[model samples]
Target chain A: MDMATMNKLMECATFANCYPRDVVFRQGDPATHFYSVLSGYVRLFRQNSEGREADIRVCGPGDSFADELIFGGDTYEYHAQAADKAMLARYDINRVRNAAQADDGMLARAIAGSLAGQLQETMDCIANDRLNTAVQRVALYLLEQAEGQESPASFRLAFQKSLLAGKLGLAPEALSRAFATLKGLGVHVHGRIIEIEDMDALRAL
Target chain B: MDMATMNKLMECATFANCYPRDVVFRQGDPATHFYSVLSGYVRLFRQNSEGREADIRVCGPGDSFADELIFGGDTYEYHAQAADKAMLARYDINRVRNAAQADDGMLARAIAGSLAGQLQETMDCIANDRLNTAVQRVALYLLEQAEGQESPASFRLAFQKSLLAGKLGLAPEALSRAFATLKGLGVHVHGRIIEIEDMDALRAL
Candidate 1:
């Protein structure tokens, strides 16, 4: 972590400490504070009109959440909750923006840089969701997770299959079918761990 | 718009500007400068091995494209072409990163801010693309076009339907079908202009 970033965040926002499994902000509540996850995981979600919760994103260490209101927009589109044992740092969006506007330099760049990274990832996810086949989507998702990994033949799933399915825009059943297809292709699935027995065959499939 | 940003850009990279329809960079070419649209529009497309074009994005005024390579990565995943009479400001990724590392202010913040906005918009687009039906996607697209308008009932489609189809991840045939559906819903589509005859009906649909 960058000490300068930590100090700037401390200067710009109030840290409302939160525990694991705590509700950070509920959907429909006014988005007041932009957050940084100092430790643990934070999940963003929304309930459909039918009241079914759909996970939006799971943010981990060094990631920020509840930033839609940072643009000075009104209202919240989603709710945020801690996924596990976690600690979060909170800051007022208005104060952060004001400080950035006043200095027009380091702090401004810090926030913008963070936002930019988030934007690029979001766009990529959109592209992935547009793919037609469940298998193709799962392949793409796994490829993204395996990106930069030293060993691509095997890796741990970042989240559960159902949550992963939601992110990929597929029904959980479709995801299960996708895994079955991969298994047929000789890929091994054990809980959250995936091992490609024949890398060439898996890639070819 | 900021003089500081302009100066920073100048110090970063040199670009040979091109006319509308000119190819700025090809899909398989070595990833080079990260281009920022100074004015007009630029379209990013990927060509299959068989040489069919698939448009990824239509970047317009104040939009920055070609960022995938900046994170110590190589290879261009998409090609860029001028969509109109356009002026693109290019920045050598290394130069900008080097400069940003040394500076803690406006220049860095501007880049970060741009990135953040782009990410959020992309994520929202992805989510919508996955969750909405074709007709719903068309409706949402129209609303976005009318976002800053005095009246939300009517607006111009920024790009041709063919281009729009590519961005929306639909076949031209499917897009035409979607347009016909929209027409049935009392939304008017003529050339590049779309007018919603009944906002309530359109939303209800």
Candidate 2:
């Protein structure tokens, strides 16, 4: 994309703030808009028919979400939510694409690249989430969230467990059961903070 | 999408014939191209970690597949296979997008309409095949049966739970558990003399 095309696209941007846990866009919602994080974090995920959501990634400052829908669908194939207080530059998909319309090569490359990225994310979700049980999925999620924390054995749930339950393909009750099961296995959960009393035990679950 | 832009987009098209059961592209392949069916059918699906293939939807004449990844990611989200002998128009994602770059509105709207269509079909199949649980499957199975049955309130088990379980992609034990769950839902299950006491409740599932 040339500087002029890029600039024209930028001019169409609008700014907004999304509080933590606020929904940005849902899987299957029209892919009419995309966003770039100026500050804070965004959660990207896909939800299944059973209302199970699987995390795709977390986008932070300088990161973008749902931009690829321009190359792929009328609706988003995934869901996006503000993971933390966030300021975002929202771009209308058509407006940006229109801005780049003058350069066919730029548009083509963008489409291919964006679509490729979307595809991989979705395929990863299916491959990872499909074969696993609720317990297994929840366990994996706990382990992932715990990683990189100051205390590797403890961390805060990024979002409410209600949200986590949907993402993990579990009913709220099922999630509670999973927590209980993990607790029995030596993981501790009190509200949002989770502690791995026995990392090995948690992993063994 | 104006005729000029549409015509220009069509100019970039190329043709290929894919045979029945041929792997058009596997899920996770680079989203370099998408296909429009000219004749026959195309099967789209996602695979689980265990190599189980869950079908999303099948593309028939005039239907297109894989076009939505343009806005989303770097790879194909699902696998596409020729279900029957098919002649298709294959569009390189970048090439097609480039053709529309001269008119961004055309590109965006074309994308929105095409992608929106693709997702609405067989999405549930994807949910069922890729992410739904045994209980959910049973619920879905019961619903599906109700639709096919002349008298939905009461119907005989098609075969046995063992066979039914396999058909619905559940193991025998998992199938039993599913039945137990459904039983709690007020669905009557006495060795295949199945009776759905509340149709709306079953539909709610």
Candidate 3:
């Protein structure tokens, strides 16, 4: 987005503060505004009748959630919760829609870009779930987390191991086994911190 | 879309004819345009290295595909093939983007609506894959197919039985077994045609 559009969006935005673990919205809530994370994290998810939850996506700073609802029906189909004490900017859907309409395609293109990126991510998730083994999925996820870093770099897990397991469509014990298997590629996991001793070998998986 | 917007869109559209089983576009092709099925059917899918294929969606007349590529990088992420002899209208992405930008928020809203609908469908697919049993999934699929019909109605399968099985994330044999099990609920399957003798009983599943 250009500075002009960004400024216009920010100008119409309202701010909200949420404590850690705050429920931002629940499934079936009216979707009147689209939210951007100004600080901290938000987790999007859905629960089955058995009350088992599936983690959809985690949004950090500058990332937005539920923007798809802007174009669809008036209600949310999933739940969102603040993963940290966070500040968010909520843009009224109508205002944003009107602004995009008035623009010379920049805002519309941006909106399209956001949706496209999200759709691609979801598609990739589905593909991985269907095509990859549990160990391969865990290894690939580590590589993704270590993306853009120098070889042999390390990082902390963004969310809990159990939640990560949910996102990867694996049982927690299965994720533990995957981590144990990844040790062969020099992935060292000590609680939330992980160190990649051989990034290339991990990538080879 | 209104008549004016529809006329504008059609003015920028080019037509393509496809034979049965024709490859409309392959994974990784440049996504220069989004396509609408003017007649017949198109199948969107992904294939693994083992040559196994997963059916993503089947688009019939009036439906669109590849809209997700409009917002992100200019490359197709999935394969599209004609399920039947088909006619498609391709709209230049840049022209559509510009026209949407100039509209009174209606065109942009329409585009957003399309993306949102696709996203929701994909999300639901994921949820169903993760949460439902094979029998439940097949039963739910039948209910979805029977949607908009009066009770005890019948409808022909839109695609082949194998394709329907793939869409429901079941093996061909498993799908057959599911069909057999569903007979108890008064779902009579005779090859491609299915008769729902008791819609309420199927829904009760």
Best by DockQ: 3
Give the DockQ ranking, best first: 3, 1, 2
lDDT of 1 by residue, A1-205 (tens): 2676557667866665566668888877876788888777787766655566655677888898766456555566777887767777888887777766666366655565566567556655554455336887777667566665543378988666766777677788989999998887766789999876655554443
Per-prediction DockQ: 0.35, 0.12, 0.49
Better of 1 and 3 by TM-score: 3
**Model 2: per-residue Cα lDDT over B1-205, one tens digit each:** 5787677768878998988778889877888987889997776667755577654555778888777655544677678887668899988878765554555455655665565344333333345654566787788788777775543388786445654654455668888888788887778888878888776676677
Q: Tens digits of per-residue lDDT for model 1 on B32-141?
A: 68988878778876664456565557898778887545544456667788877788888888787676666545566556556656665665565556556788777777
How much DockQ does model 3 earn? 0.49
How far is each candidate from the true structure, as Cα RMSD in Å? 3.9, 8.1, 2.6
For residue A28, give model 2's deviation from the true position in Å. Answer: 14
| Tens digits of lDDT, candidate 3, A1-205 | 8898788788769999999889999988988888999898888888876687777777889788888876657888888998878899998988887777677656766776787677777777776776678998898899899999987889999878876887887889999999989887788998899999988897666
DockQ of 2: 0.12
- Over B1-205, each residue of candidate 3 has an lDDT whose tens digit, in order, gives 7888688788779999999899999888888889999998898878776776777777888788887765556878788999888999998887876777676656665676777777777777777777777878988888888899987889998878877776776779999998989888888988899999888887666
Model 3: CA > 4 A from native:
A101-106, A149-153, B97-107, B148-151
* Docking level for model 1: acceptable
Relative to the true structure, candidate 3 reaches a TM of 0.89
Candidate 1 chain A weakest ten by summed lDDT: A123-132
The list of candidate 1 runs beyond 4 A from truth reads: A11-22, A26-28, A38-40, A46-56, A67-77, A98-104, A143-156, B7-21, B27-31, B46-55, B67-77, B94-104, B146-155
